[model samples]
Target: MKNNTHHKTIRSFVTIFVIFSSLLLFSAQQTHATPIDPQYIFVRKDGSSCNPSDCSQFWSFNNPDKINQAAIDDVLNKIGTRGNNNNTRKIGIGVLIHYNRHNLNNILASIDKLLPLATENQIPLFIVLDGFQYLNKAPELWNWWDQDQPGYDLKNRSNVEWTCSNGSSCATKTAWRNWASEISLAFPHPNLASPTFIQANKNKLNTMLPKISSWYQSLPQDKKWLLGGISLGLEVNIGGNYYHYSNGINPNAPNPGPGNSQSDQLGYAAIQFLGLEGGITSANLDKVVQNYYTELNKYAYQLGIPRQKIFDHVNSPGFTLPNHIITTPESSLSPYGNPAWSFYNGDAANPQQFDTLHTIFQQQGYIEWGAAEWRAPNTTYSSWYQAFQNNFNFGNTRFINISNWERIRSEPEILKAIKTIANEEPTCWVTKPQINITTDKKSVSFKINPGNNNQKTRLHISSSSEYRENGLLQNIDIVNVPLNPNSTYSKPNLSDGQYYWNIVTTGCTNQRRITAGTFKIASQSLPGDLNGDGSVNIFDYNILVAGFGTKYDIFDYNNLITNYGQ
Candidate 1:
C-alpha cells in the first residue's frame, strides 16, 4: 500500500555489508558458526564474528531423529523441573492458509517441512486460517479444481463442495473467531465446502491476527507458540523496489511502493504466469513457499517468537498432524491481490492511495521475515528494506537489498574479510582502521571528533595523501588510538584536498566500519608537487601539465609546487 511519512532514530551500528562480504571472501579461513540445531542464530561476540558466508539459516539442522529426541527430553525436563532457566521453552510455529481444494497438498507439504525446524527450536504450533476455511477444518483432506472465483467466502463452487453430514447445513458457516475455540479436534471436509455453502464472505488477516493472538497468550509461558505467516503473510516485506544490497549502499531509485501485510506479503511472494489460465507450476509454488519458511527462520529472532516453543511444535508427540498442499499460481504472487490489505489507502479495492504493511503487521508483536528468491537479481528481499525505513525518513518502508543466510552460504570472502579486520571481544566489536603510511610517506594526522556524545574514546592518526593515480601506493599509515568503551570516532587529518575525504574518525558510535578496509584518502595532490619526488623536472612538470588547476582529483601532489613561485 502507498505510505505517507514517519521517522525513528534507532541506535545505528556497524553496517553488516563488510561483515557479509567478508563471509563471502574467506569462507575457507574463517570459523563458521554452523547451525547449532535447525536455524539457531549465531553471534560471534560482536567483532569476533568474522565469517558470514557460513551463516546457514537461523539454527542448523542435526538429523531429525536426534533433534526430536533432544527436544522431547529438553521440554520434559524444563516443564517437569524448574530452575533459573526461566525463558527456554519456545517453538517455531509454521502457519499456512488454503482456499478451496486448489494447492491444498502444497500447503500440507510446507507444514511437513516445518517439523525439523520446530524440533530444533523446541516449540509447539498454532496454525490458523482466515479465508482458507475448507483446508483448515480438515487439516488433511482437500479437493481441487481449475479456475473459478470461489468468491471471497467460499460458499458455492464445484471443487469446494461441502458436506452437511457432521455439523450443520451448508447455509450455517462457522466464523474464524468461533472456530478458534474448538481445539484438539480437526474439522472434516464438508459437502458444500464450496462457495455457495459459505456464509462468512470475509478474509482479512489484520482482522484475524489480534483474534488469534489470545491463543498464544493463554498458554503457559514455556508452551507459548510463536506465529509464522507463510507466502502471503511473508511477502509483505518485498515492497515496490529492487535494490542492490552491498556495504549498505543506498541504491537511489524511484519509490517502488510500500510493503504489504502478512497475507499481502504471502501473495506478493508468489510467482505467476498468465498462460492458459496462468502458467503457474509446482516449482514456482514451492519456491514461494520455501521463501516463507527460510525467511521465517532467518528473522525469527526479531519476531519475539520464543525459541523453545517452536521446538515442541516440530518434535512434540502430536507433531504429525496432516499437512496442507499447493497446486496453483495465485498462492505465490497472488494472481489476484487480496483486497483486504494493500498500499492503496491500505485498501486493495481502491488501488489508488496506499499505506505501508508495517502500519498493519507492526501493530502487534509480529515482524515479517525477509527471504531469498533462490535465483539472483531478486528485487523483493524485505527485511533489509523494512529496517532501512527506520534509518531514512523517506517512506514507511524503505527498500533495502541486504544479504540473507543463503547469500552467506554463497559468499565466502565476506567471512575472510571480517577475520582480517577483526579482533575478538566477547560482547561487542571494536573495529579500528589500520593505516600504515600515507601517500605523503608521513604518518596520518587528522582532526578528532568522537561521534557519540559523552562516549569518550582515544583519538590519533592523520589522513594520508590520496592514492597515486600514476603509481601504486607504497606504505599505509595507521595511528593506534586506544579508545575507551563507548567513544564515538577519532578524527582524521585534514588537508587542502577538495574531496574532503568524507571525514572518517575512529570509535564511531554510528557506522562502525567493522569489516571495511582501506581508509578514504584526500586526493589533493598538487600537479607538479610530487610530495618527495626530488625536483620539479620533466617528471613533476609532466604531472602538472597532465592535470592542471583541477581541485581534488589533481593528485599530481608532490614536492615541486614551489616551481610556480620561482
Candidate 2:
C-alpha cells in the first residue's frame, strides 16, 4: 500500500512538471513569433461600374420607390457581406451621393434603404458627398452663374472656370480670394452664403451636406458607428494631371494662350481662381486646395464628427511641404496630421511612392495613414500580390479600398491578393521605447522602456554593416533576445558604428514591434578617458581616484597616469 501511494505521488509530480514546461514553451513561442498576415477593412463603392441608365434607375434621385433594392443587395452580397463567403472578412460599402437641390428627399430615401442593410450585416458605410458629379446632370444648378459667362459651361469638365461679368480677364486678386473663400465656405455650409457670389446661386443644391449630417445624427446610438466616415469630395485637387477635360479639349482653343491644351486651360482657370499672377505653381495651388478641405473638415468637426473620421480624397503622392507652405494634400486633407486617404496605382515592383510617404510620416511623427484607393497596374496575380505586399510592408497602411469592385472581383489574382491581406495579422508599433543614450562615446548601453507592463516583450538589436540603404536598416545582427519591460541591456564591447534596437511585445491578438530608435557609438575614448568627456584630464584622474578600491583597480590607475593629458 505504501509503495502504491509513493508511486502515485511521483506520477502526479511528473505530470505537473510536463504541463509547466509546455506552458513555458508556449509563452516563448508567442513572444518570438513572426506576426501573422495583415487584415484590412476592404470597402467597395456601390453601383460604381453600372451604366448611366442603370445607375439612374438604381440610384433614382427623384423617385425613391424606383431605387432597385434587389440590385443593391446583389452588389452587397458579391462584396462578401451576405454572400456565400459571409464569414470571409469585414467588407465596407461606399455610397456616393451626387449633391443637387432637387434630390434631398431621394438621397435620404436611398440612404434609408442602404443604412439598414449595412447595419444588419455589420458593415461600415463610406458616405462620399460628391459636389462635382451633378455638374453635367443638373445644368440648371449652374444656370444662375452661367448667365454672365456664356459659352463656358461648367458641365462634364474637371476644371471650374469662374470669370467675372466683365469677361475671363477681369478677375482681380481681391475678387479671386473673395470668390474662392465664398465657394470654399459654401461647399461645407451652403446655407451661409454670400448673396453676391456665384456659389450662392447653388445654395440649395449644396444643402445635402448638412442634411446628411442631420440624418446621421438622428440615427440610433448603436448604428452611428456604422458610418465609417464622410468624404467631403472625391480626389479633390487643384487642376493637376487628374483635372483633364472630360471630353477631349480642342488644342486650338483661343483666349487662354496660343497652342493651348486641356492642361493649359486648367492652369489658366487656376490662375484666375487663385489670383496667382505668376501662373500655375504647387505653392499657390496647394493653399487654395488646402483651404477647401480645411473648411470642409472644420464644418464636419462642428457637426460632431471626429477629425479621424472625416476624409478628403486626393491623389497626390505624400510629400513634405516647405515651411512657408502651411498645407498641401498631405497635410490639409489629413484627418489628423496624416493623409487619411490617397490613391496609389503605381508599379508594384518599384514602389518608390510609398518610400517617400514613409519618410514623410516618420519625419512628421504621424502614426497612421492609409491608401484610400489602390489597384494593380496589371491584371496578373503576381502584380497584384506585389502591390498588396509593398503596402503591407510599409506597416502604417490602415485602409485600402479597391478602386473597381467589378474588375477586381472578376480577376482571380486580385481576389487572391485581397484574401491574402484579409487573412494576415496586422503588424503595428504599440509604444516606441525611450532609450537612455542616443550616442555613446565608446561602448553602448541601452536602457529600454517599452512603456507597457504585464506584456511579453523581447529586445531586437541590429547593426548595419553599410549605413542605411534607401532609408532601411540592412544586415540584422541580433534579434529576439528575451527582455523584461523597463530593463537595461548593456553591450559594453560594441565597436564604433550605428546600431538599431526595437522592442517586440506579444499582445493578446497582434505582435507589436516598437522601435527604440538608433544610437551611434563614436570611438573617441582615450586610454585614460575614464570620465568619457572627450579628453583625458583632471576629471578622468578624479574618477579613477574616487573609485580606487570599490570600482577601479591598479590597471585603471595605471591607464589614467599613462595618458593623463597628451
Candidate 3:
C-alpha cells in the first residue's frame, strides 16, 4: 500500500510540472512575437515653413531658404529610433510640388534643398506632383492641348459653364497625355521609351529626359537612396468643380441622362476625351477614368520608373459600372503586363473599405500598397487611434502619409497616436476584443481570444469623460475583470452615453494594453422633443411652427400636445 501511494504522488507532481513548463514556454513566445509596423510619411504641403501659423508661400524652387529646418528636426525627433529596430516602419517625408513652366528647375532645387536633410537622417523623400491648379492657371500650357479659339464657347460645347474664363478651354485628352509626358521627362530614367501618345506629339514637346537623367547620375552614391519615389499626381481624377462651375444647376434633374450640371458636363467632356461613342452613362465614365489612369501609369513605367515606386493616387477605390461591375486601380493597371503600385486615400468611415481595398490589391497580385493621403476627424484622439489601427491591421500597407504639416503641428492627439504606434508592445490577445452595443442601448458585450495558449488578460471599461486624458485612463468602471479565452462577456444596464474600453495583458517580462474601441448607448427618444432638448415645451412648439410642413407636420404637433411637459 505504501509503494502504490508513493507512485501516485510522483505522477501528480510530474503532471503539474509539465503544465507549468508549457505555460512558461507560451509566455516567452508571446513576448517575443513582433507586431506589424508600417512606415509613416509626413507630407510637407507646398514646402511651407513648419510654424503652425506660418502661411508663407515660398515656393521651394524660387525660395528654398524659406523651408524651415526646425520643422524637419521636430518631425524627426518625434518619430525617433522606433524605425531603427524595424526597417518596415521607417519614417519618410513627402514634399508637395505644384508643377509650372519651370518644373525641372523646381524639381532640381527642391531635391537640392531637401535631399541633404533626408540623407543626413537616412530617410526617404517622395515628390508629390500637384499640377491641377497650374493647368487651369496657365493659359500657355492649357492652349497647347485644348486651345480656346476666339469665338468658341466652352459652355456651349458641354452644356454647362466651365470655371475657365469665357474663351478659355477645359482639359482634353491631349492635355492629360502632354502633362504626363512632361512629368516623365522632367524625372527621367535611363530605360525610358516615349509612349505612343508622346511619340505622336514629339514635334511639339522638348526633351529634358537626358538632362534629368544626368542630374540623377551626378548624385553621390550615398544620396541616391533619399529619392524614395514620385507620385504622378495628387488624387488624380477627372476634373470636377476644379474645371467646371457648380452653381445654377437643378438638383432634381433626371438620371441616366446628361443633365445641366457640372458633373454631367464633366462626363460629357470625358466621353470626348476617351473617344467613346456614347452618352455620359456611368459605364462610359468608368471606362474613361480607367483608361486615363492606365495610360498615365503606362507613361511612368515607360519612362522607366520602377513599377514598385510608381503610385497612382485615386481618391476612391474605383467607379462602379453598370450591372454592378466594380473596377479598382489595381485591376485596371494589372492587365498591362506588370504589377502596378496600389495606393489610395484613407478617408472612408467604414472599416470594411480598407479590408475590401486590401483584398483587391492582394487579388490583383499587387505587392506594394499604402495610403498616400490619410486624414481623420480633428475631434477625438479615439478617431485618430482607430485610423492608425485600421491601416496597421492590414499587413501589406507599406507606407501612410499623414496629409498636411499643419495638422501634425497643431493636433497634439495626432502626434500622440503616432508615438503610440511607434512604441506599441506585443499583446497576448491573438484576436483582440471589440465592443458591440446592444440595439436597445441597455448593454455591451465583447468576445476575446487568447489562442491555444490562453494567456492571462483583463478587460476594463470607462465612461468617455474619465477615459484617455493625457494618455491615461481614470475612473475605470470595470477594473481588471478576468477574461477567459474564446469567451463572451456582457455588461448589462450601461447608461446612455459614450463608453471606452480596452484589454490589458501581461507577458512574462512586460505588460501590454490595447484599445478594444468605443461603444455608445443612445436612450430611447422622447415623444414630441423636436429639438431634442429632453422636453416638449414652448421651445418645441416654436420649432414645430418654424419648420411647418417642410420639416415638421401635423403628427409632430399632436405628439407635442400629448407629451407637452413630460
Candidate 4:
C-alpha cells in the first residue's frame, strides 16, 4: 500500500501522529477504541518443530495432549477479551504445513475442531507451508544425487529442493504445483500423496496455482477468509542458502562437480536455472529477485490472490521490499544469538538500524512488515512481549507461538499486554476516522465524522487534564452514548470547575477516538443574592440591619443599597 495513498492529505497523517503520541503519553495498556483483526498467536505442540536442527512435523500429531480444542479456547479467551471483548473468538492459531501426510491430516483435524468456536468469535487461521510438500531429507531426494544431470554441482542436492525443471537436479518446481492442485479448499492437503511421490513429481508447478485458487473459491463464504494467506516458503533466506564457495557463493555449475567453486548456489541460483542468462551478480540480484517475484505474482494471480495477500517470508536480518509484506519467522533480538534476529539487535537505545531498514522499506513504498515467530532475548515471555511492544509499532499485525501458551498463562502482565495489542481493531487505510471537539463551561462534547451510527460509542470524562488508560485518576466517569456526529453528552453535577473528556466510537472491526478536550463550568451565583436565596429582598435587608453598626454591618449596608428595591 502506498503511504501517500492511504493518508490522502498531510493533515490526516498529522492527525494520526498526534493520536499515536497521545496514546503513548497516556495509555499504557488501556482499552483501545479499535481492535486488531485476524489477531494470531502461534500454538506450539501444533506448530513447533519436533526436532531442533530440522523439524518436519508438529508434536501435536504424535502427542494429542500437546494441542487440543480446549487449549486453543484458552488462548482465544485470554487474549481476545480487551478492546471489543471478543473472548469467545478472535485469537488465531499459527501452525506449519509440512511435507508429511499424517502431520497435515492432524492439523486439519484440529482446525475442524476449532471451526465452530472460531465462527462465533471471528477468528482467522494461519498456515506456514514449510517446504511445500517436498521433503529434502527423504532418502530418494537426498542421498540419491543425479550424477547424470549436467549442471548439478551443489552439495547434497536433497538439501536444496527449490529448483527448476532440469532432469539432473530432482528438486523441481512441479512438486509445489502438483500439491497445490491436490489440497482441498477447507483445509488443503494433498490426497494421501506420499512424500516420495511428491519428490518424484517435482516438475508440475504450472498446473498448481489455478487449482489452488479454485478450491479457495469453492469453500463456504464464512470459511473463505479463514485461510488468511500462506507465506510462500518458510523463511526463504537460510533454509540452506548460506553455503559459500571458494571465491564465495556459487553452488551449481554447467556440469556436475565437487567442492570449491560450485556453479549455481541456492536461492539466487534457482532463479537463473529457471532461465535467466546473466547470473547472480550484485547488480543483477535485485533484478533477479524482482523477476522471481514477478513469476510468483503470476502464479498468485492465477490462484486469485492479490499481491498484498501473499506475504514474503525472509529469514535474513535485513530485507527490504519496495511493495510487499515481509514476514520474519523465528525472529528475535540480537543478543538472543539464536541467529534469527536480523539487521537490528534488540538494543533499546540504538534502534536506529532497524528503524533505518524499516524506513528504507517504507521509502520503497512498502506499508507494513512483521515477525511471524517472535520472542525477546533472555527475558520472561511477558517481558519478551513488552520488548516487542516497546520496539515495534503495534499498528501492524503480530503473532506469538502458542507453544508458549503456558508461559503466557503464567505471566499476567504478558497476557494483558498481548490482549491490549490484539484487541485494537485495525482500520483499512481508507476508512480511518478522526475526531473533533466542541466544549462549553458546563459540558464537553465530541463528533466523529462519517460516524458509526450502528455501533456502540463511549464518552469518558475525567477531572484530570490528560487521558489515562488505567483510569487511576480521580473523578473519571465513562458513559455509553449514541454513535452520531451530532450527538453531544453533558457532564452531570459538575462542581463549577474545568474538566477534560474524550470520546471513542467502536464499529464491527474498526474504532476511532479523540484526544481530550478542555471545558469549564462557571460558578452560578447572582451578585446581590447574599443570603443565597434565589431573590434579594427582606432576607438581605434583615442581615444588613443585624450588622448595621459594625464593620460587617458596613458591608451589609453596601448590599442593602445595591439591592434595596429588589
Candidate 5:
C-alpha cells in the first residue's frame, strides 16, 4: 500500500513539472518576439471618440504653427509662395456650413490642413458655418454667423445686392444666408443641442459671398482670399460662386454618377463626423485628408482647378506612400523587360495626358508612387508611348490616365520620358522664383545667347551655403558687365582648378537668370617644378602611393594624404 501511494505521488509531480516547463517556454517566446511596426501617432486620436460629434475625438492643437508648418512646408516647394514668407500672412478661407456635433471634429481637421496654405499664400480664411461648438476646442477656426451679433451686418456694408449681384435668380445664395441666420438664432450660445434642418446647411453657405467680399474688402489690399471646405461647403464655396478655386473631395457632394467612387464614400462619412456637433476621431480626419488626395487629379480637373495646384499637395516627398513613387532605382524592375511605369493610377483615357502629367510631376523632382492596379478617377493607356489619341478630350484639349496604360520596361533604347525630362530642365529650377545650382567647382562661363555676343551680360554667383533648401539664393555675389560678341565670361577666374564656385548669368535688361549647366571650378594649378615643390622627395612618393594603392582615397583623399609628405 505504501509503494502504490508513493508511485501515485511521483506521477502527479511529473505531470505538474511538464505543464510548468511548457508554460515557461511559451512565455519566453512571447517576450523575445519581434516588435511591431511603428504606426503613425496622430495626437488628436482616441478610440472611443471615433464618432464625429465628440469634440474629444478631434486632434487637439493649441498652437496653429505646427499645423501651418506642415501645410506651408508641403506646398511652398511645389505650388510656390511669394516674397518674404515668415509664414505669418493673413489668408481668408470661406467655408459655408455649420458642422453639427457629429461632424464638428472632421470640420476642424479639414480647416487645419487648409489654414497653412492660406497663411503661406498670404490669404486669411473666413469660414462660414452654422455653429455647433466653437472657441477653445478649435483655435484659429471661427464661424461668423455662429457668433451671432455682428454676423448679419458684416455683409451689408458692401455695395453688392443683398443676395443677388446685378439682378439674377439668387435663390441659392439667398436661401443659405437665411439658413445661417436661423441656425444662429437657434444656437445663440453653446448648449446640449441646436435644432436640425437641411435649410441650416444651405443657409450657412449663402452667407459666404457677401460676407466674404466684405472680409476681402476689409483685408490689406495686397492679401489674397482662398476658399476651402468639403461637400456642402464645397458646393457653396466653389460650385455656387463660380470662383476659380482648388479643394478636395470635389465634384460636389451626392455625386450621382454611373462611376460612383465607393472609395469616395469614406469622405462623406468623414464629413458627417467632422460636421458633427462636437468632433470626430483623428484617424477619421486623416482618412478624410487621404480620401480627398486619392480623388485629387480627377476631381480637381473635373472641378476646373489647374493640374499644377492639384499636384502640389502630393509634392511632399517625405509624406510617405499611397506614395508608391519608386523611391530607390534598385527597387525598379529594370532587370526584366517590365520596369514599372514611372507614374501612378489606372485612368488611361488620354495617353498623352498620362505621359504629360507624369513628366510635369517628375520635373519637380518628386518621386512617384502608384497602386499596383491603376485606381485613377479617369483615362487609360493601351501600351507604352502609343497613346489613344482623342480617346479622352476635355473641350479641345486631351487628358489621359497613365494608370490604365501598359507598364514601361526600362530599356536601353526606349529611354524613359521621365529620364529625358529630368535631364532636360535648364539647370535653373523655378517654383515661385528662379534658382540654379553649380554642382561642379570648376569655372563656368556663359553669355545671354551662348553663340551670340551682343546681349548685355550679368552674372550672379553665390556660395553653396548661401542657398536655402528651397533653392532660394540669398547673399549672392553679383557681377554686371557688358561683353563684346562671343566674349567668353569677361572674367576667366572661374577655371578648372579654382572651380569651387557657382556662376549665374542673366541678360542685363531681361531680369531673367540664364541657366548654365552646373560647372566646376578647375583644381588650382600647382605652379613650381614639374612636380611637388619641384623635388623628387617623399611628397612625390606619397602621391604615387595614394594613386597606385588600393587604400588611397578617390579624389582629395590621396591629395591630402600626399600634400605634406615626410
Candidate 6:
C-alpha cells in the first residue's frame, strides 16, 4: 500500500511538470516572434517662400535664396535623427517643390542645397511639379483666361470657368504629359545639365508658365534622389464652383441634364467631356454623374499621363473612389494609380473612408499610399500634433509632407509635433492572435496570448479589412477581454464575407508597447455572390442581369466576367 501511494504521488508530479513546461514554451514563443513592419512618418517642408495666406498669387519659382535654410536647419537639428531626443525612430523629413515656374532655375538651385542636407540626415524628399492651371493667375500665362483666345467663351462663361475656357481647349492633358516628360528628360542620368535643353526649348518656353522639365534636367544625380517621388499638380481635380454653379458658369460643375436651370453650355460641355451618355439611364443618373470623375481618370490616362509618376491630389472632399477603377499599365493602379487625399483637413469626418481608401488601393495590389500635405491647424504644439496625428495615423500610408519648413523653423510647437510623431513606438504583441471562423460562417473566434501580466487584451472586429467606415473608425466594434495567456472570444451571427481582427495588449508600463495580433478572417466570397451564398451561380447571374445598365451594372458585369458560374 505504501509503495502504490508513492508511485501515485510521483505520477502527479510528472503531470504538473508537463503542464507547466508546456505553458512556458507557449509563453516563450508568444513573447519572441517576428516583429511587425516599421511605420514611416514624415514632416514636409516647402522649398519655396510662397505666401502662407494665399497659394494663388505673387508666386516666385525656385529661388535658391528663398529655400528657407534656417527653417530646414532648425527642423534637422531637432528631429532629423531617428530616436533622437527620445522621439520615434521612423520619422523622416520631406521637401516639396513646385518647380513649374517660368524659370526652373530658382527651384533647381533651392533643391541643390536642400538635397545634401536631406542626404546628410538620411531623409526622403518629396517633389511636386505643378500641372496646367485653367485660370492660373500667374502673370506668365497671359492667354490662360483671355477672352479672345481660341478656347475662350463670353456670356460670363469665360470669366466664371476653371481650366479651359471651353471644354475642347484645356491644355491639361498636354500639360500633364509635358510635365512628366520634361521632368524625366531634365533629370537624365550622369549630370543635371539642363541649360542645353533650356536653350533648345528657349523659343517655345512660356515665360509665365513654369519650366519644370528644364529644372529637373538641370539637377545633378545626387540632387535628384532627394526627389524620391514626384507628385504632379497641387490638386489634380477640376477646380471652380462647378458643383455649386447651376447657372451656366463653373466649368467643372455638374450637368443637370438638358432642360434643368443649371443646364446649358457648361453642363453640356461637362457631359461631352466626361463621356457620360452611354452609361446614362434614368435610374443611374447619379451614378453617371459620380462616374464623371472616373471618366476624368480615364481621360487622364488616355492622354498618356504617367499614373506611376502622378500622385493625384484632392484638395476637397468627395473625390475618393466610389468603387474601383480598372486602368491600364497595371503599375498605374488606384491609390498609386489614382492616389488622392486632402492637404487642408485635419481628419476625415468618416473614419471608414480611410479603410475604404486602403481597401481600394490594396485591391489594386498597392502596398502603400501617402498622407496628404500637413499644416498646423493653429499656432499651438498640441493642435499641430493632433492634426498631424489624425491624418498620418492611418494604415499603409508610408509618406507625409508638411506645408513649409518656415513653420518648422519658426514654430516651436510644430517641431515638437514632428518629434512626437517621430518618437511614437508601435504596440508590441506577445503573439499573433489566432482567428477561427466556424463552418457556418456565422461566428468568429479570436485567441491571443497576453503580452504582460498587467496588460489587458484589447480586441476589435470589423467587416472591413481596415476596421473603418466612410473613412472613419465609427463602425469598428471594440471589446476589452480579460488578460489570459490563451484567451478566447467568440462573436456569433457575423455576416458572410471577409472580416478583420486586431488584438493588442493594453495597460502596459512600456511606452513602446507593440500591438501583436492582426489577422483576417479565413473566407473570401466571390464579388458577384449577391445572395451571400458563397458562390456566383444562376441567382447571381439573374441579379446581375436585372441590375444591368444601371449604376452598379458595370461592376456586376466585371464580376460576371471574372467569377462567372463560380
Best by TM-score: 2
User: For candidate 1, which ten residues in a row score worst on lDDT?
Assistant: 311-320
lDDT of 5 by residue, 1-566 (tens): 99998677557545634654575566445433321111000011121122343232122222222234433332223222221222212112222334443244454455555444454565333232332222222211212233353333222212111112211221111111121121111211111111222224333333332333343334331232242112221111101111110111223334321111111111122334235433333333333333333232223223332221121111111112231211221121111001111222223323234443344323422222211111222222323222222221111111111221111221222223222221232222111112222122233444332311113334555433222211223345433444333345534444332111223333222212222222334343432111323222333333444454364433333343344322
Better of 1 and 2 by lDDT: 2
Q: What tens digits encode model 4's per-residue C-alpha lDDT throughout 335-392?
A: 1011112222244212233554454333432223435444444235455555545434
Residue 454 in candidate 5 has what lDDT? 16
lDDT of 3 by residue, 1-566 (tens): 99998677557545634654575566445433433223444445545344545554333544566554665665667555434343334556777765433344545555566655665666666666544323322233223223454223322333221222221354332211121121111110000011322232221112322233344445453334355556644554443212222332323333221221223234444455446675545456456545544454445544443344445555455332232222244433322112222232334322346455656544543334556666555456776777777765553344567666655755678776676665563222132232222223366666564532225667778884232211124567654487776677788776677776666544322223333445566554878876544555554655665786799765675687689787
lDDT of each: 0.26, 0.47, 0.46, 0.40, 0.27, 0.41
* Cα lDDT, model 4, residue 268: 37
Worst 10 residues of 2 by lDDT: 184-193
Tell me how candidate 2 scores on lDDT: 0.47
Error of 3 at 535 (Å): 87
Whole-model lDDT, candidate 6? 0.41
* Candidates by TM-score, descending order: 2, 3, 4, 6, 1, 5
What's the TM-score of each model vs. the native? 0.21, 0.52, 0.49, 0.44, 0.21, 0.42
Off by over 4 Å in 4: 1-67, 77-90, 100-117, 132-227, 238-268, 274-301, 318-352, 378-386, 390-413, 423-566
Candidate 1: give its CA RMSD in angstroms: 26.0
Q: Which candidate tops lDDT?
A: 2
Candidate 5 residue-wise lDDT at 39: 7
lDDT of 2 at 280: 44
In candidate 6, what are the lDDT values of residues 1-566, reduced to their tens digit? Answer: 99998678557545644654575566455444432223345566544454466333222334555444454455568664453332223555555444333455555565556555555665554555443232222223223345554433222221222232343353221111122121111110100011222222222223211333344334443333233344544543322112222322333324222221232212222333334564322223223223322333333333333223234444434332222221111212232234545444434322234454545544533333555565435677777766655554544344566655545555677777767766765342122223222222355565554433225555655554321211222245543444355656677666555554445443323211223222233343668666555665454555655565674455565575478567
Looking at model 4, residue 31 earns an lDDT score of 20
Candidate 2 pairs with clashing backbones:
36-425, 37-424, 37-425, 38-424
Ranking by lDDT: 2, 3, 6, 4, 5, 1
